[model samples]
Target: MRPNVRLELIRKLMQQHNNPSFMKKIIVAILFVLLIVGGGVAYYLYNKGPLDVISSHAVEISAVNLYNSFLSDSAAAGKKYAGKVLEVSGLTEDVSVNQNQETIILLRTSVEGAHINCTLEDKTKVNANKGLIHIKGICSGIGDGDPDLGLPADVYLTRCFVINK
Candidate 1:
């Protein structure tokens, strides 16, 4: 019985050594799958544009409600609204272009509270002097200020489109 067990162990070891190509094939297969998956992900990301709030269903919110929510608990608000499409309707406080040539629309809730700073793709679409407007944008996140330029902007929204002016 002991001799048979030893013989079986030796046979298994010999089989494993002889089947080195099995491990190689498995490794090659895994690497090939990873490469294909990575390429597919890259292609999808490259072609896919930002979320269009105009065509899709978005959360409708007033600028004041959005501001108050963020002001109360920024982390919770950010988790809820960040990267999501939103339709924000409010009075336009100011409109200006940043260094990147993006149109920025500031919608202030009050004098002291936070404001929703929406960045639009086209500056020509929105008039800088407009009053109340409805903007559809992707909420980026809340901001206290710009440390580099010393600008104090509150909530930041990007990829914005003016639904109504």
Candidate 2:
């Protein structure tokens, strides 16, 4: 009620906060709560299964057209295609397994060295020798190639699966 009483109360509170043991307890409690929350989140994410691309709706486009769109205006194309599902049809340039053992398919474009790089979900499903194919996957956007090195820009797709017509 009185000024002296209030001042004494504030001083006591500040002294308690300044105490090393009191501060340590507060820090430990905060950290413990944060650790529990982090662990729960990690567990939830770990138990979650991968996306089912087979049944999902996708945007259909030819590999050459997709590459041309990115080449014309990458910013606009990225906004339209990135993070979305795409069913790309084109002639197979190459198919091989990466270091991670994931099947990587390159869909050919008219431009030399440029292709739609699709990472397949099921390695055993698609054959490398297949002339033409339609693959469905999520667009991961374009990889900028080096002009001096003569590398062509590529559009990347992940979690891809062969679309059976």
Let me know the TM-score candidate 1 reaches against the reference structure. 0.64
- Error in Å for residue 2 of model 2: 70
State the lDDT of candidate 2 residue by residue for 1-165, as single tens digits: 999999999999899998999999999999999999999999999998877788888999999999999989999999999999999999999988899899999999979889999998876746778588999999999998999989988899999988778
lDDT of 1 by residue, 37-95 (tens): 99999999999986656797779999989988887898999999999989999888888
The C-alpha stretches of model 2 lying farther than 4 A from their native spots are: 1-48
Task: Report lDDT (CA) for all predictions.
Answer: 0.83, 0.92
- TM-scores for all predictions: 0.64, 0.69
RMSD of candidate 1 to the truth, in angstroms, is 9.4
List the pairs of residues colliding in candidate 1: none
